[model samples]
Target: MTVSSSTECVIVKYEGRIATVMLNRPAVLNALDEATLKELLYKLKEVAGSAVDVVVLCGNGRGFSAGGDIKSMLSSSDESKFLPIMNTISELVVTLYTMPKLVISAIHGPTAGLGLSLALAADYVIADTSSVIAMNFIGIALIPDGGGHFFLQNRVGTTAAKQIIWEGKRMTADEALKAGVVDEVVAQDFPKAVREKAEAWLQKPIKAMVQTKQILCEGNKQSLLQVLELEKEGQFRMRATADHKEGIAAFLEKRIPVFQGK
Candidate 1:
């Protein structure tokens, strides 16, 4: 079955166990306005509540996103009107980053500012070789928001993250890949790569994958002992699932396991 979300700037389509999320405002390179940001958050929440095993996030047009809408910002003078929208964006970053379902970002064209934040928050990021990537807040006399600092620093280390944000240069896909910003750089056929990756992951034990993701996402903040304890607890829980039994049986039988996400 296939279903599309009724959102203004964001589109969500679910097929089988996979949900594809698209940032759909093509005219401004998918630049997010207040309505768009709220819609994206709502869609993410809906996806999290559903039974989707994996999520693939991408933009609908030539660019992923140009970040927050500058026009909106420029027009608004009252901090009250603006701060709520900014808060929404932050919530969006947190939702995408910590979602139980494994999230993959397919980036192309110009991705910068909060747009890059959204991509980095995902579990995996795949970009086209010709894509322009940046942390571009410096150009606007602003700093990276929407957890951009945390994501960049986590991926590429502190110094590089700082430099990337400070310089605010448009980075080539090769440069971004070398910096460990994105997981894969596809020379061509960006959509094909995303589909292949989503299909591959969907075949595995999804519940186990989500459990592993939870532990790993919290790994940095915890001590080794705490991480080990989580691993132990997680292992204990996973051991009792139906998927685990199927996996063991498949291994003994030398056949593929069919995981039902139980």
Candidate 2:
């Protein structure tokens, strides 16, 4: 049996015990705007409440999500517009991290910034060989958000996480795996690999696995919330910096940014 609950920006499809949630905006590499984020949050909650043992989060088009929408960033010049968006992101990240079901992020193509953060929240991440992963918020003179600080530190330790964030370099799938950013790298038939992995997990004592996840996640949930709060305040301050202005200008102009460190 197949069940689908889809919207303009997010698609939810359930097949037996597996639910697949796909980011649907292909035009801009699925760059998440406020609307898309809200839709995704709704669908995630719906799936969390369902009977699915495994949830596969993926993208519909050529790649997984690129990150937050650049257009939205350009437009949200004030606190009123920006805070709401950040809050939504925080809620969505928390929900995904605390979800009872085993979550897998199947990543392909460019996954950077907030997109990478979201993928890190998953229980396991499977990336295609050609996929590029980055925590490139520094390029925009912005700190990582969406519990990125917590998740990255959890995956790769604090020192390495700080280095990666400061350098803002993109990593190939193998490099990401080496850096402890992703779980598995698929060389061929990426979709088949993800399906087989999911099927294999389904054959296990999934309820016990989920229970263990719940215990650990619940214990650490408060820490993630605290990081999210710090990110919100820090990002707001960064948005007001002169470096941020120059960074956005350089990005739009397709030139190298000269950050003033302001």
Candidate 3:
């Protein structure tokens, strides 16, 4: 069943087989405060296990995200309070990383710190030209967490990833695309552009798409032989799906397939 979360900090909107998870703290550029982070974790878990064909993770307001609330983090001395938020960040990132549903990070505005982490973790990241992105953890004297190391390394090579982290400079959408961070960079009208991309994914065989996402994500840490075994199992699983049969039939008939994600 399609489910949506209506929490204060995060808005989970489900429609047309897509769950759009928007970070709602626009005033501070959707800063990752404790409450917002907790709500995000809850919503991500809710969608991760749901039957939604795709998830579009975006931020509401001027930018995609600013990562953390720098002021609150700098002033706070309470480990009890701060640590839980950090832990929740870990959970949210992991959920996005391992989820079977296809996730697309629709970015606009300034995405920095762990915000970049979250975006990189997604299966597809599409941003408009207005977006500015950076690792920027060095500014706070902190290392990149939230799977930043893993995701960035996966996209760019280790050398480039290390250079990016060390430089800690913001990059334009074009530069990001060159770095292999932003999958597609459109002009203005990001809302429409992003939705169009998601809707296009909706037209394909979603179950197989999700299974492919799983195989690729796990392939990162797995050996070549192990990945081959995974591919064998995955191929078998996809072959048994009704969508697969429909796909084969459609190809044979030279017609478009109507996939129900079965």
Candidate 4:
């Protein structure tokens, strides 16, 4: 696949069997605005049902992602406006979680808030010595969304996941590895190391990987129809929140959000 750039913030590059999804906004530390999310979603859909053997998700500039674009959120805070943005985020996370292909995240630098959910959805998460992972939702007076509440609890147990979100503590790469959130901690030249690992995964039959992923994901599955209803209910509830307004507003203003949790 010949990878092309829809814009500077996103680039899709394919070499041999590995498709690389790079977050290109290094200047802003790859902070994800609405456009970035849209581009990413479009790119992901582009690769859907393709013959790509493996997918590598990484950031271009300083880190993987600094989380959602605060400026973008704060500027669009009416519940009506905010709900769609949140919907987009929710869909992205769910898509990544259930993706048929092997998704690997090469995380370096800061991955915060919604970005953390993105990292957690990947099949394998590899971080460098300098990487940082944080929930940081409480820092802005918001509860964890974007499936962080569900994914983190599943990975690290409910009690610990609650503590992490409540405290909004940012974990270093080593700390994340110790907590089992990340699969491996590499040395300084971590990107290359992660690429090597991704390349290796590409050599195997994708069906085997997909089957293993299905089993792991299925272990906790409820009736499929029930789960879909649950997700719809969540969307309905979040749409009624005052904090959603604040979150979107503060993001657009590039200022700290004052979430009243109404």
Candidate 5:
């Protein structure tokens, strides 16, 4: 069943116990603009309250997502416009992370910046071999938001997480898997692999699995919340930086950015 119309930025389809939530702005590589983020949050809440046992988060078109909309960022010059966007992202991340059902991120092509954070929120992440993953906010003189700090630290520990964030390097699927950034990497037939994995999960005692997830997530919930708050404030600071202005200018000009320690 179709939960969202084609015109929506996010679309939801249900089949049996599985609900697939797809990011729908293929023209711009599904970049998360304010409307897209809000629609996603609403759809997630709807799915969370439904009878579905599993949620598969994926993107339509060439790539999973390129991250936040750079165009939107350019437009949000003031706190009044920016903070609401960040808050929506925070709420969406929290909802996905705390979802009662099993959540799987089916990643393909470029998944960077805030997109990586959203993918990490899932209980399991399956990446196609073509996928390139990055915590790339540093390149834009910004920091990762959407609980990136908490999730990256949880997956690869603090030291590696900090290094990855600072470098903002892109990693291939195998590299990401080796670094413990992704759960599984599929070289071929990515969609089939995701389906098989989800079906296999369905065969297990899913309720008990969800219970364990709830316990662990609940126990560490405060840490994630704290990180989100820090990211929100830090992002605002970064937005005001000279380096950030240079980064945006360089991006628009399709050139390299020269950042000065300001």
Candidate 6:
């Protein structure tokens, strides 16, 4: 079932109507690098065109994803790489949001920033109780990217989304469920429950499910236009701050971020 990638950044498995795309970097807590992001986009694009009735996104080991690869990104001498990489990450989430098939994220551990955006873009999000989900961009003096602002606002509305993203608060799976960020919180029976849900979804007519997905996405599409514009402006402003640089550095140093709120 494993579909090998050219870059070996992502692994895909197909069984019946479901295609499981695994983020394959367990060594670094599945932290996303540029290549991983590109491979994920490519894999999702490929799946969208296939006969796959549903897609399940998950990570291999401890975490869903630790967001971006701070070590790799910060170690690079070039700052010019940031915008393009962030844009591609944004496109990946947008792709997930607009995909025709039913998409679900099975998040077990930490899902932060772009990772949380990816989950929120899905039709349903299934998280384990031990998981931590957060927007987390403000901690780095950056605004939400990877369509985080757009997807989060769609789920939790403007006020809650503002508090979550602006405050960069880490939410428990139960809290995320209450906030509508997670559709289900499965503590002990996650694997079985997720499988049952996916199997149940596959029982219905694929076209009907697809159309329903389209209708839901269409309802939210108009809102993304404004959300994305505001998010881009926020990122532009955040990148200019000294705290942003310090935040990234602090993350790499494994120390607490000291943001002056500048």
Ranking by lDDT: 5, 2, 6, 1, 3, 4
- Candidate 2 residue runs with Cα over 4 Å from true position: 1-7
Instruction: Give per-residue CA lDDT, model 2, range 1-262, as digits (tens).
Output: 1123344798887999999898888777789888999999999999999999999999867678889998877776666888888899999999999999999999999898988899999999999987889999999899999999999999999999999999999999999999999999999998899999999999999999999999999899999999999999999999889999899999999999998789
Please state the error at residue 66 of candidate 5 in Å.
Answer: 0.5
| Clash-forming residue pairs, model 6 | none
Best by lDDT: 5
Each model's TM-score?
A: 0.80, 0.96, 0.79, 0.83, 0.97, 0.90
Ten contiguous residues minimizing lDDT sum, candidate 4:
220-229
Q: How does model 5 fare in lDDT?
A: 0.93
lDDT of 1 at 82: 51
For candidate 2, what is the total of clashing residue pairs?
A: 0
- Model 4 ranges with Cα > 4 A deviation: 1-6, 218-262
lDDT tens digits, residue span 1-262, model 4? 1123345567887777778888888767788888888888778766655677688888886678888777666567565766576667766766677777898988888888878878887889999888989988766556666677777777788898889888889899999888877889997678679878987886778788889888876764443324334544664575457876676567567887776657
Clashing pairs in 5: none
The sequence of per-residue lDDT tens digits that candidate 6 reaches over residues 76-156 is 857677678767776787788888889889998889977787777888899988798888888788888777877777788
* C-alpha lDDT of all candidate models, in order: 0.79, 0.91, 0.78, 0.76, 0.93, 0.82
Full-model lDDT, candidate 6: 0.82
Q: Rank the candidates by TM-score, best first.
A: 5, 2, 6, 4, 1, 3
Model 6 TM-score, all chains together: 0.90
Candidate 2 lDDT at 192 equals: 91
lDDT of 5 at 153: 97
Q: Per-residue error at 154 for model 6, in Å?
A: 1.3
